[model samples]
Target: MRNFNKNALNGKRAIITGGGGLLGPHHAIALVEAGASVTLVDINEKGLKRAKTKILKVNDSAKIATQILDITNLNAVEKFEALQTKHDTNFDILINNAAVNPKMSEIGGQNSGRIEDYNLNQWNNEINVGLTGAFICSRVFGSRMAEKNKGVIINISSDLAVRAPDQRVYSPSESFDDIKSYKPLGYSVVKTALIGMTRYLAEYWGHKNVRVNALLPGGVFNKQPEELVRNVSKRTLLGRWANLNEYEDAIVFLASDSSAYMTGQSLIMDGGRSVV
Candidate 1:
């Protein structure tokens, strides 16, 4: 990670979806520190406000911008290309970080479920963000990056893909981490789909010099219930949820030249949760 310096992201531009949420602001903070001009996008005005305020506090001269956008807005996403041209600006990095999780999932946190019971509408919503959001953003920002012949993308992911089977409360043969994380069956399925999408983009864009990757994060502990956390931590080697700041360096590295040659891969940082 030390191979990357403060100016590694200098003069670069980034757009982080879900910028008002837990991981969004941290991404903004680290990018600004690394010298990237960032645009934080979210559907919530309050979140956007808080994110911008926090970013400016870190660097008075930070080149940070905020946009109120719902990633699933098909018309807006479709027109993004023309919009960028009209504004005389283009994005350099696209972070697909926005999502609507278990609140819509059918499992409703029951800690168990059958895939057949999945909610179709909820599944669509999750897939819309995980896949379509990334697709549209990639097309928009990626076009500009392709023009410049260089760019990077980082999709926020989860460790559920390879999380330890032994740690699950239910039978190992009957994994239900998704049911545990949020309600509904599609949560895990969508995340797994994201990994596949990342690989496809990396392969398709390699010759164009644009890299796409995913970061499978551990349970982020802020506002988490102690009991809930302890239960989750046992599966992880670290035996604890991640502090918000813990994600900063890894994200910065992926956004910078430090991991230029690395693409189309999932970087799992679940405190060894997958190994237990």
Candidate 2:
């Protein structure tokens, strides 16, 4: 039996895309706690500042860096990669976590919840940020990892990747016709596509000792409306949504040698929502 060291990532470096979002800082904190230096990449400069502040508040000595870059632009990403190389910073882990998720509050009116009314621009934007961005980052960062013959790539998918969104949860009232919001088609499509990407990359980089996988996390409770929370809770076996930091340990496990033998797999961390 091999002994698992909690500090297995002591000197490892990681790069997390979408590092300015709600969960991005949490993921960075987890890695830093496990002894890894982290660089967070996102287009939202303000959000990146907030994420860094949040992480530093937890651990003043945490090794965290933030960069504002559009992941959809291949040239931009390549430039960022060149800069990191110039600094002699080779990332040992890459977390494809950046995405544009449309909330219920952001939907309705011209942005109708109905599929037929979905705007083309919205679809393209979401797909570009959530899907294309992931591809570009993997191409730039993962390829470098392959050159070194060791790395891990984790695609942050959603539980919706495995199961379709239960549209009822978006309904403001008990009546089905009262659905004021929806989980956009692009959201699910992007997440589902990530699964396929994970499989392909895992195999493509396996010989190079680069392991790739996806983390399909369920909804996190973030001050959503009471009714929405109730509806989502009813569908989940755990009877509630996940807390903000719930996925941190899983992120650390995937990024570290703890999951050494795991590859090309989707690790679903929904509150048993998919099962029920």
Clash list (residue pairs), candidate 1: 106-184, 107-184, 108-183
TM-score quality measure for candidate 1: 0.86
CA lDDT of each prediction against the hidden true structure: 0.76, 0.90
Question: RMSD to the native, candidate 1?
Answer: 3.9
**Model 2 ranges with Cα > 4 A deviation:** 1-6
lDDT of 1 by residue, 1-276 (tens): 223478888888888999988789888888888889898988899999998888788788988888888777767865755687688677778888887654222333433334555556667887888778877787777767877888898988788655432323332233554334333455676677789888988998889999999998877777655545656676668878788878888888888888988999999988887765
- Candidate 2: residue pairs that collide: none
Model 1, position 28: C-alpha lDDT score: 86
Candidate 1 lDDT at 189 equals 66
RMSD, each candidate, Å? 3.9, 2.4
